[model samples]
Target chain A: MTATLDRPTAAATGSVVGAWRAVWLRVEGRWTWYRRHWTASLLASGLQPVLFLAAMGIGFGSQVRPGPLTDGVPYLAYVAPTILVSGLITVGVTEAGLPVLSGFKWKQDYWAVASSPVSSGQLFGAELVWIALRLTFGAAVYLVVAAVAGGWTSAGALLVPPIAILAGVACAAPVMAFAATTKGDGHVFAAVNRFVVMPMTLFAGTFFPVERLPLPVRPLAWISPLWHGNELVRGAALGGLRWWPALGHLAVLVALLVVGIALGRRAFQRRLVV
Target chain B: MRSDEAIISGTGLVKRFADFEAVRGIDFQVRRGEAFGFLGPNGAGKSSTMRMVSCMSPRSGGELRVLGMDPDRKGPAIRARIGVVPQQDNLDLELTVRQNLQVYGRYFGLTRKEVRAKAVELMEFARLTDRADHDVQPLSGGMKRRLTIARALVNDPEVLLLDEPTTGLDPQARHLLWEKLFQLKQRGVTLIITTHYMDEAEQLCDRLVVMDGGKIVAEGSPAELITRYATREVLELRFPPGDQHAAVDKVRDLAERVEVLPDRLLLYTEDGDAATTRAHDRGVRPISTLVRRSSLEDVFLRLTGRTLVD
Candidate 1:
């Protein structure tokens, strides 16, 4: 009892160090869970990307001809960076979907955390930071595998992983905001995957260029974070993207990331604080 | 803080939801080093009041102070100094039993070394040292409740608030939990418990408030409440179907009060044996008769005109 009385009130003190320490504790919880379950995630985020690089770049590359649509490069090199970008978008959507839902509804772990010294906004911020770190690590592994498979045509391909992280979090933040507001079982997540995630992955120019699609459906690709992500990755890896167009893509991804985080933080407070 | 000051106090405290009011305006104070309770039925706003006191929910209207701080302004700080065990078990099912304690301690800003030591100590206190590495999902109901209580103690909080701590446990488990709570009280950790069990209130709380329909109907110690609102003994008589109403009129003049139920008639009086004799003298025949001391259950019945558990 004396120890309790003598302890400093870090939560009320409101220092920068104390605030960051609160958020770091929540991130450690995610890291602990990941340490125990890394193998399953490695299979999905790591090995699966290499297999797609092999099947689409090597096996399917044999029939494709290098032309204006291919950026005059081989199919393997052409598809490698964009596939890495697309894979991370998928990872972001996966991370933001059922896991966020379980934290609020199924497991109610968010309420448990809310009862502690950590605030609801801090919990949401910590989640975004953890996802960004996970996406960075997964992107590094895919880059190594892509390099070994001769997926890059230039030295600038090394810059693609960081850009992939931006797009990944850009995709994760809004999805996390949506998950925080929803209730009940995970059928809504399935609908998000089918109607939202899959369409962006397929039509956002992962397998082919967006110009190949009909004019009416082309604007759908323009609005997707995956398309902006693909443009940046393709330019960085293949070395033909101009500076002005690259800035436009960067701005889009950043706006999406910022807006998603704001919405997610508000939703978290509504669900957990009450 | 002085020992004489109220550890917690609420004056005209009210909690209103969007469409309905949960805790109507009420006032209460809890002194240091004492066990306090909110005794009521399921929807009597006990949990709502507990939530407000725990700093988890904002008060709709009124003044509340915990540890001399306003909950709305200092929620995180107030929450840091107090422990909370919610109605349901919200253990992290993904973590092991030991990991659950260690990780939860980190939320309170404990060092890794401190959390490690605290985890070992708390696991022993909860009697969960043997199952330290097991996941929380497979634990029994009793083990889960014990673990929840142990987790709440990680920060060595000044006040521990438990909402229906032993609601679904068996008799053996309930007794074990009661013993643990008694030990905590002995160590001078202020305990605030909300429960519907009359025996639990009698066994744990030094003073309690009886709540009904979002209002406190009465407030006193268990013996004081039973002595004031009820007679010394209750005489219960079982009769045939539809015969209780007839027996009520015949025995109405014998006791202080007569309560009719579907299966039996209760006669409240100073002496149950004398009441039974007077009913017998009135030519009223009962199939069975029982005499017992008045309890908190009888007090609740007298105040609310209903049973506590029904």
Candidate 2:
């Protein structure tokens, strides 16, 4: 109080592009929080993916025969890229769940940000960006660990992290839209874990090829964004992806991400600005 | 062209929530570098109006302007030049005290270097330099409120909107906060505050509007409103709890007006001593009697026929 500074003229910065820059600024806020608590998130983004690789890929792979279903590759090599994508998806879903609820309802940090120069749409974009960054970090850690575990067969495996990030966004965007509309303490996140994410991770060709599943339930794997992501990452890592099929899987993930972002923007606007 | 002096102006502003109208078309203007206040009870739409001015809530109808820009279209632009301290402390509890200031500063497009320097200045200004690295969750309510005020100042805003700035604060904390606000006023920061405490309005507000039932019932400076709606002094007569009603009938004509409360009767008059002596001469035999100068509380009660706070 009674303090003075060289106050700059308050013309809105960047006019048109300022909104986008504000989105990054909001992401920067989350990054500050993440920098302090990244270790806490390590168990979810790092350890869990490595544990799954050890338990399902290496431990269980030792018993299974090298067969045509696994395309003559070792089980650890076959499942490594898929688990990377799965780990990102899990991180995406969890990030979009309670944290989104807290932003809207409990903590209301979204409202606080909206009170500033940032718009609700920009804030939503920033949240997705933060989630994407987390996915990228998780994917990087998983890729390094998997590479050391003899999971890499081709240089195309380097493309897995980006593909995993796309998969995470595809899963995160819609769940964030749903989370934006929630009012309770996020009990639905548990249901999303048990009924949606867990099943998708298990049945979407992470452990075995979807072709091995019963035909009736095979459509679920086809419909799951995780499966498309797994296909893209595995095809890239294993160097077996056909051109048209790969494009089709990429298109599906992109469509889901686009639609989810559209719906998410509307939900956030209603919750924050309205 | 709009007047540069009028930082905030609203005409026939209305706010409705489904079936209920929160603000029923009120008009007001706040000039540059002046402390303006909305004094109202809990349901009196002060917060609703504040939200609209802050550009966080869209108005249901009518025209509103902040810093000469329409809030409906220029929300982010208008919000960029102003700071808002909401009724509740929405400070980021997970972040350290300094981080809270740094993060909020970045939202205004301040660079990390600028924010860091400003955070240091603000921490010192709020007298929280010692708690700079500590998490915000452990700070006292006064510290949080002070930090919020400091955060609001990060943008060097042209106007600062504070809703119930010291509602839950203790007496000493409230005084400290008021001292800070008074300093802000001295520094030429336009302040818009909403509170039910008459003393807060009288102490901080250069001018204020008394609102009730979604409408402004009175508008003037504290002393002006007191003079217009209340007497210069008031005499309080307590004649046992149950006898207050009976006592009102005896001293009804002794003062300009008589108000009967549960445990006491208030006599509004220009001269409290004269009224009290006249009441005693009439054999009123009051259990206790006291005279006090009229306050904004008297003005509010006279305008709305109820206490400012329930």
Candidate 3:
């Protein structure tokens, strides 16, 4: 067909739309890569969650009593929702950060995509979508384990999927932005986990309320995704949503997801367009 | 893509890495169904030009059109319609040969059934039907390269781009790849290839541009280049390494042109037989003598003042 008219004129309009469609296909192909490797996913998603639920919820629940520590509720029930949110954070971090970087540089997965018709923005979107799917697997399995541990006091605990998804989006946003800007393996992510996630999981009312922390340190709970997800999950599970505060937490996570995806898109454009 | 009148055309194409000029300034055109080649050595900017043409890297400065679409703006459209065989085999090591084709076909937006059919056909074309389900990691370098070529063909591109298409392959592999490419040409597929081998240029390219240090030093058909820049035949002389310079000086005027190297002497002449007689009359007894028809290598050496291989 190039012999009749001109060739360059046709390509300009096509590359963008082509890039978008190509990315989705790449996501499908990458996901299909683990079909035969289901044994690993089986261990991580099915078995690991049950083990964690038993050890962290049942074993540790016995050590901490109700009322003074868990607002007079069963310790296992109180800790279960918090762990569900934290589990999302764990899976989201792995799927969004290290894997993203490895695909782009270390493993040269991005090179394979770039050489194709796919654009970088589209690939990044597909990457996020794939991560979201992986997060769902872990979150759903953990929610089932939470239910089996008798974590629910209200029927609304069935809304675990939405709550966990929101938690994942909220948690994945900053990590996505940070991943886009990452050049080499930086200690910044490691520090975020150690100084931020670890402390937040330990102190941000995962086991008890923020009021139990030092009077001045209670505000630290506002910045953690774990706190927001915890509030929503715990509020629904224990039949005690503050209404206004739950909406506020949900809004913060939405904003973070927007910012993260936007930043990631821009970074992909900047890095790949050259 | 445009009406496919001009598969590729460029005006004042320039590509540079920092201040280093990879392609200083070149203007060219490639019509559909034609086979074009860039014959140059390493550091000759052949790969750089190929990259720019493929729209993977931006041109430093130029007016370039591929399939009548601006490469800078419509990279995906151009790429979708083109098949690329890079110098190195960049096959997906994680997938099977059939899956590699299937996945690459999907990247071009082929439907599921379309890719499946394409995979089967490509595996047969590459003669890897038996290894279609095997992981690509264990495949030989030649098999991998064939699969890469097969993957490129999944999209059924109008124009194909190849860079050093058979650089490291054994003769059998190179012959098979060449046969496949020839078949594509017969089917009216436009091909743009870059290579440094004289024989490869002779066997494939209808027209070629010879480049050295980012600038095209000459441009012609394989035979035309030899006729223009080199004699019809060449006489080679190998002397003791230590006395090469003295031997070259002793027989400087015996041939039409004399190129003195550290270990050998190249005597360019219209009749290599006459040159041999002249050398013999001059009392020059070389360790060895080889007289053969001139080739692109001679033309390239004559224009660039250096050998093609290191």
Candidate 4:
């Protein structure tokens, strides 16, 4: 013990490499836990999205014709890309809420990490990095399953997975901020799922075009990141994506992501550093 | 093992919550390789002081230096060399017992090979080698506590801060933990422990401070505090509930001081057996009587006029 105590660890140096090493170690902690429980997470993040794609894109799309709303692509092709992004919205909301709060109040792993050399900002960055990785992996699995089910119409569909990942993180970051403010009680997350997440997924132009809805309710889709994500993905997959609307969608998602990251970082710092 | 050099020091340290002060202005220093303790009851700010020293909480309006570095600025560097065992065991339940140690070592940026080797050594030291592969959630209270301590040592820290390390453990478990801490002290790790248990302070600390209402009432070694604040021995006499006050008046002049409890009257003196004899000769009869050596509890009672544990 005396010999080991004389040898300083990397964090004792307080160098940039040491800071990034702390972040990577935190990510490794999450990965170590995920290794044992990947089966359940795979079911939620991967299989569920593919199942939704099969059920809605094939089973339901057979009844619909190529209409102006779908830009003359097959209904399966149109619905596949939107479901990919919307499925991630559900995954993002689920991942961000209870787990973040549990890390603070119940399991208290965040507090455990807090006492270590790791700073709160570094922990926040590691959490988002891990979330982004999970979204990327899940999107890849969903896209492969969709291609097997005859959902891909063009090589342009490769762009949808990256777009889905951006939107998933955009939704997750702000919800993580809300979770950090909650006390141990999980009822608020249930309300978020019931009142906010469910409605947003349903009306975010995922199932049908927002144009078919009443005039007054159209702004609801316009304000949703998921709706923008759905538009960008569907447009790119079917080869009709225009430049100006694409940039607008990109800007909306990026703005949400930047704002969400800022709030999430501050919330984690306030909750943990105290 | 003690030193004249102070490894940790604070000057008029204060900690304020939003509307309440948890640690009022107080000053103390800890020498290297010594078992130092903060003895107080609940809400006495012992834990707050420990947090400040561990770099987990910032002091509100005072200077605190741990290992000659400012905690507010050099927190990560200082924390990298210190281990904290919080009041509660916050072990990672997602990992096995061994992984808990390994992963905690990684937080300090230790290499995977180093943590793997360190985990095995610590598992043996904590007596958890048999339970190494088992999940942390199913371990008993004592095992979890031992593992928490072992995790704190993953960095081979120079100082270990234990906040109420044995609050909820059974007696046998507590003795086991004390032995482990004693070993650490022998190996030259500076220990700063906060506990409400007087006997634990007596057994572990070479020097300590008695805190009440977030202020230091007395500071000395266990024997020195007993000599300074209290008599060498104490005589306890328990009568029927209402008769203790009458007994206190009868034994008032026979001892240095007398404390009247609802059920018992205490006589503070240099010789407990002699005091019991003198009181018996004075015709102060009681249901039960005993003579004992004075302890830290007696010193705390004398200093603050209150018991150390509620």
Candidate 5:
């Protein structure tokens, strides 16, 4: 009896370590799922962005081109940052709200994770990191396609990648916090996409310059992370940075990222530990 | 909290959900490495108590300590040492079986390399090594449950909590699950399960508590409870409609106890054969006679005064 009693004590530490390794395994597993049915992810994230680049870059770029939207450059270069930033936004928003909720309600995955040694903060943090990595993949794809389409300039355009990532985090961070508290009939996520996402996409200058909007509407654009990403990525592409405003904009993104992280941690504990 | 001793201890445990009281008040201890069960029909509040022990839901009234620590104050610490198999599979349908184990391991902060090694080990343990790479959505129900168990053990918890682990499964699946649970118990993993099926309670639980209307009706080993609360043998008689009462009076003196119902007559006694013989000697013949040993179902019925909800 004594010998048997001592066995579980020895196994406890090993189990703790084992539980810690489980989070990334979830992401690796998701990769295989995506590979087998690549079209599903492709339709939602990859091909849709590619099509946006084609339609907006070629079709929409035609009207604004040989003019001044790109300041004598091509229209593709003008909208490239917007597409990249918008790409990140879509990932963060979709991943944080509906997908996270699915983990709670549809699948027992979150409960399974919670039952392990893992803290709610760790789970939330890991998911956000995974979401960030996914955004990078999507943005990189858009950037490569943009460069291949004769839209490349100086190496400074590399700024679009991080800016795009920031935009996605900016949009996703607060929404993730909000999603943890929501308990409606679930169709509310659709409304968020329509009202929140669509307006951010349109007014935050996905297709045009925010400066072109009326003064009152521009403030709404200013509040959006898409605008900052649009500003930074567009600035880097066309070499148009006002040092103070650009620095200020980056700081806001960083601040929001921190707030999102803090809020996500609190929300996860509240929902999971309940 | 030792492996061979009680790891979970509770005193005056009570759980209340607003105006309703799910677990009004109760106290139980689960020794390490024993297959303990909370057997009850629906609304018996078994699930509610389970939620408290799991550290998922807060205890409304009493003190609950698993692994010798209060879950309310040290939630993560307690959960870290426990493995939980919820009533549902809850496996990530979007991932492969291997990924499910790995991701669950990562939530506890395991390194990538360690998670990989552990995933392989768990898949083998779950008997799903061949299906390790297959999507979870396509696995059979039995396979899913095996995976869920495998996922729960990813952390090698000190106490394993399973709520109605075999509820919806077919007999073959339930038996397979029982076999797996038996192996866990053999390895000295403390098990706490809740089940409505008395047969499952008999087969898996070493000791269990019978619950009805949110209170414990009885608690003991399967054999002890059956003997204490039920007859040693049960005689079931089916008669052609209106003749059951006449047959009942003739057999009433043959047994220690008798219960008459709309469908059948049950004679409770120490010797069913002797009782049947005496009934026959009295020329009270029935359409059918079934003699069998008393089981946990009979005990549950005796204690609860109600049939289980399917």
Candidate 6:
């Protein structure tokens, strides 16, 4: 009976449409895994952000009277948008780092997919897309909860989720490029969390103005994508962002994202193709 | 694209890692519906060659074609037609058995509906319907291996590439896998397999190449290779371990060739019974004796001077 089975026919050619479909296929795989295991990551990506908002925006806001740094706004409102961007950045970086390494070294699921019709470039693009989707979901949840907590003082705050997603891709793409180069047991990912992500979250003007930082350390925020995202999110949410500076921040984030994607594509091809 | 043309053909195929050459200038052809094999020990370049053919690894230097298209320019196109089961089962431990098949099918551009149906059929083929919804981590080694094979078939590939298909499987599991593979062969699917097991090669391969030190040392049907490199039958004589050298001197001229192993001495000749009788006439009886037909193992040992599995 098995002898009557016909061989599966191959696709006619590697057309552009086929390539795009392959990319979405990888995205679907990631979505499948996310659906099954998302609860394990919910605390880190979802609950932790809300807890931070509660502790820092409400608890800490009550201690600080309205001031210049707060732009005469309540501390909860001033800190809400910044936390939204920072939280998405955290989720983005976390998703792109160790998981990317595990895809290559531990689980080797990347290799398994690469053996099929999917190209390395498509795999890299799908990873960034999945990270962006995750960041979008996490940021949207945080925005709704913050709004319920009275953190939304301006109608412009509605734009923060999309901006937060851009910040996430900007952060995640570069980390994924670096992650593709890692062949170890996640020591690099741990080091990145400790040395790069933690410091950036604390010092990227999330809670206050960057000018108050020590002069030498202040430039660090200038180069941080999170800081630019923070400024944009806060400006849009607070209704006082100057047009030129917001455009400048957007340009920097876009430039970083482009460079990150280019590097990541090349790195994935190098690691996966051989 | 002619039906009579080779499905995979390579000339001067080479793969170098850093300064080390894993596949040194080798050549071969695989036709449609033929079961071909690469038989070698670990690091003998079998996996490297398989990777190159699968289009997962670009050739360091070679003129290669799969399905009549250049791999360098048409890897995804070529890969879409071929299935690969890697040496290590990289099944997603977090996903259920069914999801693993579904996700892999999607990579080949199969739609959700198509993959769903294909996954169901594959679950039946792999005999994992009972464990279809279970996580892959807790499944036994045989189940995982079978699942990997079933997943590769999700696309119904015209060619299936299996790397050491049953290396770590138990005897029963190995037999089951071999049975499935034989079924695949009967369906006229071109199979490219790499295994260090001579029994597996003999059982499944229509033609095969023996590799050692990154080179193809011999290539033919298993029977042809055995006839060319080994005697028709082997006489195994076990003596005291320390006295094997002495026994070899007594029975040296009785067979066409002799191999001295740690625990036994093998006398290779056209007739094992004659060789054993000759050994007995020489008054060299010390331990157990047995006669068996020559197999691919003896051929491999003759060509490479080393065991396939070490």
lDDT of 1 by residue, A48-97 (tens): 66777888988898789988889999999999998888888888888898
Interface RMSD of each: 5.2, 3.6, 6.4, 4.2, 5.1, 3.4
TM-score of the B chain in each candidate versus the native B chain = 0.97, 0.97, 0.96, 0.98, 0.94, 0.97
C-alpha lDDT of candidate 5 relative to the true structure = 0.79
Query: Which wins on lDDT, candidate 2 or candidate 4?
Result: 2
List model 5 lDDT by residue over A1-274, tens digit each.
2232225433543344333344554455456556667677665665556678888887788777455655677888777767878867876788788878876777646777677666677677667777787787787787788889867676877888888888787778777877877776458788988988879888898888778999988999988877877888778878968899899889888888899989987987888875
lDDT of each: 0.87, 0.89, 0.78, 0.87, 0.79, 0.88
DockQ of 6: 0.50
Compared with the true structure, what per-residue lDDT tens digits does model 1 show for residues B137-248?
8998999999999888888877889999999999999999999888777767789999999999999999999999999999999999999999999999998877898888
Tens-digit lDDT track of model 3 for B1-310: 3334667887788897777888888877787777899988898888888888887778889889987788888888788888878777767677788888887778788888878877887788788999989999899888988898888777777788998989899999899889988877877778899998989999999889998888888988898999999999999988888666777777787777998777889999888988888888888888999899999999988998998988
Among these predictions, the greatest DockQ belongs to 6
lDDT of 5 by residue, B51-147 (tens): 8899888888878888888888877777767778888888888778887887676655567787787788777777899999888999999899999
Give all TM-scores, in the order shown.
0.95, 0.95, 0.88, 0.96, 0.87, 0.96
Candidate with the larger lDDT of 1 and 3 = 1
The DockQ value obtained for model 4 is 0.45
Greater DockQ among 2 and 4 belongs to: 2
Put down candidate 3 lDDT per residue, A1-274, tens digits, no spaces.
Answer: 1221223222211123454566678777876676645676666434554566688789977787677567568888887777767766766765677667666556555666676688777887888777777767777777776777787666877765578677776677668767767898856678777887778878877767877788778788867777888888888877768879889988888888888888888887665554
For B1-310, candidate 4 gives per-residue lDDT tens digits of 2366888998899999898888889889998888999999999999999988988788898889898899999888888888899999999886899899988888887888988888988898899999999999999899999999999988777788999999999999999999999988887788999999999999999999999888888999999999998898899999999988877777998899998777898889998888889889989999999999999999888888888777
After superposition, candidate 1 runs with Cα above 4 Å error: A1-17
Question: What is the overall TM-score of model 4 with all chains considered together?
Answer: 0.96
Candidate order by DockQ, highest to lowest? 6, 2, 4, 1, 5, 3
Q: Could you give candidate 4's per-residue lDDT for residues A1-274 as a string of tens digits? A: 4355344322232112366777788999999999877987897777777888888889989988988877787889988998989888888888898988988888888888888889887888788778888888889998898899889989989999999999999999999988988875888989988987788788888888888888998898789899999999988898878999999999999999899889998999888765
Clashes of 4: 0
